[model samples]
Target: MAYKSLLCVLTDSDFLEAPLAQGMALAESQDAHLDVLTLGVDRSQNGYFYAGADALMMQEMLARARSESDDIEAKCRQLLQNSELRWACDSGVAQIADLGRHVAMRARFADLVVLPKPYGPNHGTELEPTIEAALFEGQAPVLMVPEDAKPITAPETICIGWNESAEALASTRAALPFLKAAKTVHVVVIDPPVHGPNRSDPGGLLSQFLSRHGVRVEVDVISKTQPRVSDCLLRHATDKSADMIVMGAYGHSRFREAILGGATRSMLENATMPVLMAH
Candidate 1:
């Protein structure tokens, strides 16, 4: 499976038509094949085996989830089947309990995913749980959009939070396909006032590298004087009207370490826009 295609996510209702449209636009801009997926999560995957789900009831529950997802999947496909799109629905073979995992597994084959912003003070309370699962459990870089947004190329002003870490590197690498394709790439280096040097310097280094390939690069060196770097990035992205944020996910082995130096944890907690994260 090629990890170069785009995946669009949807709910059973049309309240988020804007995100669907943007997802389509995102897919077309990158010359990626588009796959629209709608999910109706039944039981959490955890409950199905170890100690929760009733085995005899599993098949029935899975069937109902598929039935619910089917209509939305069909509607999404109809809405996006113009000449430019090669679209399909995954309401084909699935189980509700495993939908999140399946989406994550299949996302390995996709270059990116266009997801509706799972949280907003204004969205219907009904969609929250399903969205939450995708945010944490789905293993893809999500291009989350506003509920009312129209289709668009990723913002010309792109902000990448550069840190020397695996998740960040994965995010950087995943974003390269887009970065190389973007009209403008802004590398923002948030500097700690007391620091000697920021480790990665991704914006500077990547800008120079992409310039050789004809991409227009801009660099914004910021001093992390106010708020933490994570919050600063969010503020910068909003202030610049940055279309997307690219950054690494920071993680540590033990429970103690995970809390001590996890920037990804911070971003995931506070991010309010389409953030491309790779872990």
Candidate 2:
């Protein structure tokens, strides 16, 4: 019924404090076990592709990576030592592509996975792919904390982007812990299907289900046309002063979204608030 085990991925020095603090706070609140995972990118294969490149530069890069990973692990240990909840730290070194799989595999045993927004492509972090892997491969709900996400406060108001898809249902169920504690739960359905099981009463089924759990649920349908689903969801969240958003991770193929575009990708790229997503 609640998060009993939470995984928080630590990537960069610039982004560590927020997620670390947020994860610890959530663990404390739920009386859950917190696992801090620090990642170090493996670049040993780089020599094969860039045979002519300077070996010294690659060595320096690997050393820096190790140093940063150690720093993050140390910080996590220090923080965990002062926390009341059970906590542990784990560190690993893997190639960029392999790292995602590693994290996803670890996430499989967790109740909730926490990650930061992907670093900008130009920034060279390559942590974005891990987000997708964690959501889809790990088959778990992901709580993405924005860089600006401060120390966690229980969300009083939460907005759910509902479409009645399996993805949406998974996210809603995964978010029950938060929804049950929230003062207000708004199930916003943007442009519901004209004819389907939910056509007649979009959000009706889910709203009732939540109410049964003692959640203060409200259903809101945005009948007005909107340019993009993400825009509508964000606008509704803003209007309601929502602290967090719960929604499906990707309703369409990741490749198709990358080639075209999708709501999940839009939210991941632009959401200013914390987003809890599941695939």
Candidate 3:
């Protein structure tokens, strides 16, 4: 009752290379399909993200873009050749690139997506157009990768941010495959309300659910006064040496989710490990 395939969408950017490798390894471990998709967002395209730029900006951007694209393809091909998996790349049609919109379009068919976090330089934010599109427009589970994601340990452990919400339940169900692979699993819920005598049930039905599936589950109860679940979860992950994070994504809508106003957004922006989220 778990996913049998994973789509690893790429756009020839260096930022995604290592994360793609990590995603591929994850897919292989799960016995899933690894589909590599590319959208060469052409700087020359009149309506593309690069179209409204200056002349010099366009030139260097395209050069780096092509170089990154070439590197992504060659590396992916090499990795696929040596591994026992089905992997391939999609390089868009002709010279046109969909950039963020393209990636967003293909996101519909993927069980989960993995991409690199953007960094701003000299006051310029790395929140490139594509990242924005995927986070907001792409209606799929996406895993954002930090800079140093290569040594991401599989056998260590992972944490799931839990709450009584649809998104949370979806995230938990989708994360079963990964949780089953971890050496340890923690289903962390923070700061439950002070109970009256009528509240007979404890706050760990989710933990019991995973336990039924054979996951090594641990429950944590923290301060309700802190008012920052994201900070609490991140600290917990660090303390427990969690390699990946599993949490339900609650948002009013997809477009508004990327701004990441709540603890979930904070966790995603500040996550040291790969985050698995489903809308």
Please report the candidate that would top TM-score against the real structure. Answer: 2
Misplaced by over 4 Å in model 2 are 43-60, 119-124
Residue range 41-86, candidate 1, lDDT tens digits: 5643535474676775776766766776777776776787654766
lDDT winner between 2 and 3, please give it: 2
lDDT of 1: 0.63
Best by lDDT: 2
Q: What's the lDDT for all of these models?
A: 0.63, 0.84, 0.66
lDDT for 92 in candidate 1 is: 44
lDDT of 3 by residue, 49-107 (tens): 54566888666666766665676677677667787787767665323445666767867
- lDDT assessment of candidate 3: 0.66
| Model 3 regions more than 4 Å off | 42-71, 93-100, 118-138, 151-154, 194-202, 224-227, 250-260
Models ranked on TM-score? 2, 3, 1
Count steric clashes of candidate 2. Answer: 0
TM-score, candidate number 1: 0.73
Clashing pairs in 2: none
TM-score of every model versus the real structure: 0.73, 0.92, 0.76
lDDT of 2: 0.84
Measured with C-alpha atoms, the lDDT of residue 217 in candidate 3 is: 82
lDDT of 3 at 167: 77
Query: Which candidate do you rate higher for TM-score, 2 or 3?
Result: 2
